[model samples]
Target: MDIDHLTEITANELTAAQYFHGHKCPAMPQGLRAGHLAMDFLSVKRARGGSELQAIVEIGDHHFSGCFADGVQYATGCTFGKGNITKRGLGKFALTLIDPAAGRAVRVTAKYERMKMCLEMPFFEQRRQGIPPYALDPAVVDPLIDDVVNRQWRDMFEVQTFNHYPVEPARESFEAVECAECKEMVVLPYARELEEQRYCAVCYQARVFRGQASGI
Candidate 1:
């Protein structure tokens, strides 16, 4: 989340593919890229209730073709969502050149591509504070939101995921089975207690069934 570190890394990345094998410049297109990113952040927040960015790094689009980071695709807005387009010209998506001694200067350009967007935007400047920028993508967002909402309901009130089972009323005992050997009687928990009583409780544990009930 350090913008200065991201800026340093972005400036030194290699973009030598067939698509991005253009002249490598030490500095970013200041005015254009920075301005576009700012605007995108504001618009995204206004519509979706808040800002959702993780780590924004400026890199060449071609370098992202088959590259992946932490199991996510590098480009095409795969980190967030492809359909996540922000409102035009409503936020801080402007490009500016930074000079430590002189001061940060804005660079004018036609338009800033999303890949060219950098992480120079400060966290405090964000409209929605404390929210990470990673969940902005629709693909990574919907399921996460559902998980949070459902987990809360489940934990708060022991809510079952599926339909509840219908409770059956208790039944009365019909016939009591008495053991002739010990005179111990037990009410059958289930129906049809015919062959259920072969031995008394003590004899049952002592292997008395072997002598009494013979044959299969």
Candidate 2:
């Protein structure tokens, strides 16, 4: 499982990741690099619509670098639709990639010192000025992505690995039932029962269930 992280990832792989990510930015590629590193270290293959691996991203909503998770998903094949990715809501850019079957995991973070260089780049300056990354000029964004993809992992990331990482195995549900309110099919475990009528969480009178609204 000792492959050179620098050489193992290909340009085509990053291109696919960028396409899946739908924009060019350093944070996403930083995530791509980190995920590639973790997978290589663990000697694991990318998941194919299954929970072969899991990603816990320390990133909160409405913050910078949240795009990192997309990169991780592209590289490791852990995705929300597959129920293999989770957010820690810690408002940071870090990935804990896990191979549950092997009990192996690697936590990767872009080094703050190096990341500051990225933040100071002109690309981020435009981002700070209320311009969306996708709308930014390619000249501004492309250079930053190039820097991220070409940088050495030692300069870019901090990696902490575990051989005996503890993981709660995922429970896959195949059974579904109709919601009493919206009438949509929801997984049996995710269905909520209130007054003996099952409904999906969204239609379950959430405020009432939480004792905040009337009709509990």
lDDT of each: 0.28, 0.84
TM-score of each: 0.19, 0.88
Q: For residues 1-216, write the lDDT of model 2, one tens digit per residue.
A: 544434445789888888998888888887888888988888888888666899999999987778888888888889889989999999888999999999999999878988677778888788999999999999988877887788778888888999999999998999999998788999999998887889898888663557655543
Worst 10 residues of 1 by lDDT: 64-73
Q: Which stretches of candidate 1 lie over 4 Å from their true place?
A: 1-156, 164-170, 189-198, 205-216
Best lDDT among the predictions, by candidate number: 2
State candidate 1's TM-score. 0.19
In model 1, the number of clashes is 29
Q: Residue 22 in candidate 1 has what lDDT?
A: 28
Pairs of residues clashing in candidate 2:
none
